[model samples]
Target: MSDAIVVIPTYNEIENIEAIIDAVFAQEKAFHVLVVDDNSPDGTHQKVIELQEKYPERLFLEVREAKTGLGTAYIHGFRWVLARDYEYIFEMDADFSHNPEDLVRLLAACQEDGFDVAIGSRYVKGVNVVNWPMNRVLMSYFASKYVRFITGIPIHDTTAGFICYRRKVLETIGLETIRFVGYAFQIELKFKAWKLGFKIKEVSVIFTDRTKGKSKMDSSIFSEAVFGIIKMKIRSMFTKTKPHA
Candidate 1:
């Protein structure tokens, strides 16, 4: 098994699952993949099982009974990887939005550069997103700005789903106490990591909106992120001790 593993959370991503897996493995670096599927009716998990025959050791799957939320799925994945021997853990979309080629750079940031967390950021170098509506681009750009102003975290892309984390960062941050279930989940993890004094670096990457399958994003996810930051900031003020592994 490789020292690094990418955790992809999927609902109904059959259209892109096979190609994405191939792209990740095609990289020069060898990285294992764990698919946390939400029992997609489209037989997404079944496809993973079939492909597991091809990449028996490098690819794995976990099928949940029902579709919960995105946060819970990742939290589950975190716990799974933490129990194993993997050193570098990643969060990526199964869709092609987060390029597989960038995974190598993200790993380099944490492994060779000694950063604790590496974010595949879309805003660190300006607005590098493609195929998104103007309204959405504006909303996403300003949302990161709002998160920075409110939480005092210096990250440019606060809600970015593409990320690489050193194992210790996950162990330091209290994963079970993570509350938000949508985009806010991404913010909370980064905020807690920063609060615990983990070094974070953002690698500039272009986010191409997915062409296949429907988007999981909705207004409720955005709304939660907007309001959740305030409550998270307030709670942090009272907590004095850093979370233990």
Candidate 2:
């Protein structure tokens, strides 16, 4: 079996699933993919099943019952990957916003550069996002700034969904304790890893707005993140973090 796996959580992503799988497989390095689908009525799981026949060994699919939050989908995927022996694990979006080609760079950051977490950062190289509204651009940019000021992680894109993690980092972190299920989940994971003294490095990458399907962003997700960080920081203060080996 391959030592690296990319876990992409999906919900009604038919327009992009097949293409995303192909893009990842087209990479120079051999990496496996696991699509954790949350019961996409648009036959997304059926598409994955079809691909599995072609790339039987490299592709996988897990179909869930209902629409759960993004964080829960990833947490479920994390547990599935952890049960196996993958050394390098990744979190990517089904939408082409995150370039599949850059997965190699993320892997290198951890496999060669000694970083435990490698983020596919949009702001690491001065706001490299494309085709987003000016208002959204400002909100996302300032959101990272607010997160940095509050959490003090030194990361340029704190809510970035595209990331790669060494297996050991997940093993050290108590996965069951992860709380927030929105974008805040991203911050919580990074913050917990940082608080435990893990090395996280941001790899510069371009984030394009998805050209197909609808975006899942909503006001509630933004609100949860705005308030959740404070709770997470407070919990960290009261809780004793385990030492990294």
Candidate 3:
């Protein structure tokens, strides 16, 4: 198996499952995929099962009981892939919002450029998002800024889901301690990595809102990311910070 594995979490993403798997495989780099499907009612896992028949070794599946949070799905993927000898682990969406071509760049950031975490950031260069409403654009942009101000994490797109982690970073982060099941989970992971002095680099990429599948974002999840971050920050102040591995 290749050292790089892209872990994609799916929840009712049937519309985009097959196409996404195909796209990832089409890339020049030989990256394996681990789909942590939440048993999508629409048979997202079944589609992956069908595709796995053709590329059995490269494509892997982890069917979950029911719809769980995105954070937990990724955590499951992390543990599964970590058991193996893969050096680079990636977190990507089933939808087409994050371009598959950028996976090479993310890998390069870690393997070639010597960074611990590489983020396919939307705001790293500027607001390079398309098809999102103006309000949504502002909210997302400001949310990153808010997270930076409160948590003191130096990232342009704090809520970006498209990310790559070196094996050592995940091994050190104590995956069991990860909290927050919503978008805040993204921020928390980055924060913990930064606290431990992991080198993180942001690669500017345009985010095109998915046209096929429904969005997973909800008000409750959004609230957790917005207000919950302050609580996370306060807790961190009292707790002694751990050094990097």
RMSD of each: 1.2, 0.8, 0.8
Candidate 1 at residue 145, lDDT? 98
lDDT of 2 by residue, 1-245 (tens): 89899999999999999999999999998999999999999999999999999898899888889887999999989999998899999999999999999999999999999999999999999999999999999988998898888877799999999999999889888899999988889989998888888999999999999999989999888898888888887788899987697
| Alpha carbon lDDT of each predicted model | 0.94, 0.93, 0.93
lDDT of 3 by residue, 1-245 (tens): 79999999999899999999999999999999999999989999999999999888999999989877989888999999999999999999989999999999999999999999999999989799999999989989999999999988989999999999999999998899898977788999999899889999999999999999799988888799988899989988888877874
lDDT of 2: 0.93
TM-score of each: 0.98, 0.98, 0.98
How much is the lDDT of residue 16 in candidate 1? Answer: 98
What is the lDDT, from 0 to 100, of the residue 157 in candidate 3? 96
Best model per lDDT: 1
Quote the positional error of residue 115 for candidate 2 in Å: 1.0
> lDDT by residue for model 1 over 169-231, one digit each (tens)?
998887988999887899999999998988999999999999999999899998999998999
